[model samples]
Target: MHWSDRYVGQDYVADEADCAVLACSVAREVLGLDIQLPGERRPGPFGRGALIQQHQADFARRVDEPADAQPVLLIARGRAQHIGVMCRLVGEWWVLHADEGAGSVLRQRLREMARQGYQVEGYYQWL
Candidate 1:
């Protein structure tokens, strides 16, 4: 199955299918790696420290340049809270993620999100 098949139409549940979970799930599927997220099922921030720690241990290395199908983490309020897979649709860079505001999985143009003040904290490749 393709990575996008995991939860393409799934609605975003606070702890269930949030941005991080969606990203991690796709990464797991595409890269065939094991990623264990915290058991807490809350909608708020997943704590920057914990996220950084997990990424350090699991992801291969920090990527300065993101390519299509790469996993990326987004920062909000100085905390890493959102994540998605980088993709190109219609010759523009987009991110496929479980958007809480949208209440479902959707693809948004990366540049548009940045213009709207979304901070891309880091990008990493699955190990």
Candidate 2:
């Protein structure tokens, strides 16, 4: 079974089942990759700014083409705020992410997210 199955229908919870939390969990469980993002230890949101930027610089490598199990970032408003895992489904690329509005894990097309004001910034493989 794919590692992501465990998170497919999980209800979204800030600082728990939210994007960063789930994405980070997916990374470690599915890809054996470990990452520490903002707000994990203290009271704040995940991937605030400096922490994720530095984490990306130190441990992640950006890729032109996304692949299965890669972490994909979705830009909200002007800054990138949401994250999801790239999953191959129905022969196309889909993002499995946690959505607060949906109140659960959401699987959406790569293009659909862009239309929803969440642009696909890029995908990353954590090392």
Q: Say which candidate scores most in lDDT.
A: 2
Worst 10 residues of 1 by lDDT: 40-49
Listed in order, each prediction's TM-score against the native is 0.74, 0.81
- The most accurate candidate by TM-score is 2
Backbone clashes in model 1, listed as residue pairs: none
Residue-by-residue lDDT tens digits, candidate 1, 16-119? 67776777777677656677765644435656436555655455567898776677777766676677888756767777888777799877788877764568
- Candidate 2 lDDT, 15-79, residue by residue in tens: 77788788878888878877776554332334444345555656567889888888887777676
TM-score of 1: 0.74
Q: Evaluate model 2: give its TM-score.
A: 0.81
Every candidate's lDDT:
0.70, 0.75
Candidate 2 residue 57 C-alpha distance from true site, Å = 1.7
Q: Tell me the lDDT of model 1 at 98.
A: 84
Give lDDT: candidate 1, residue 14.
76
Model 1 misses residue 32 by how many Å? 3.3
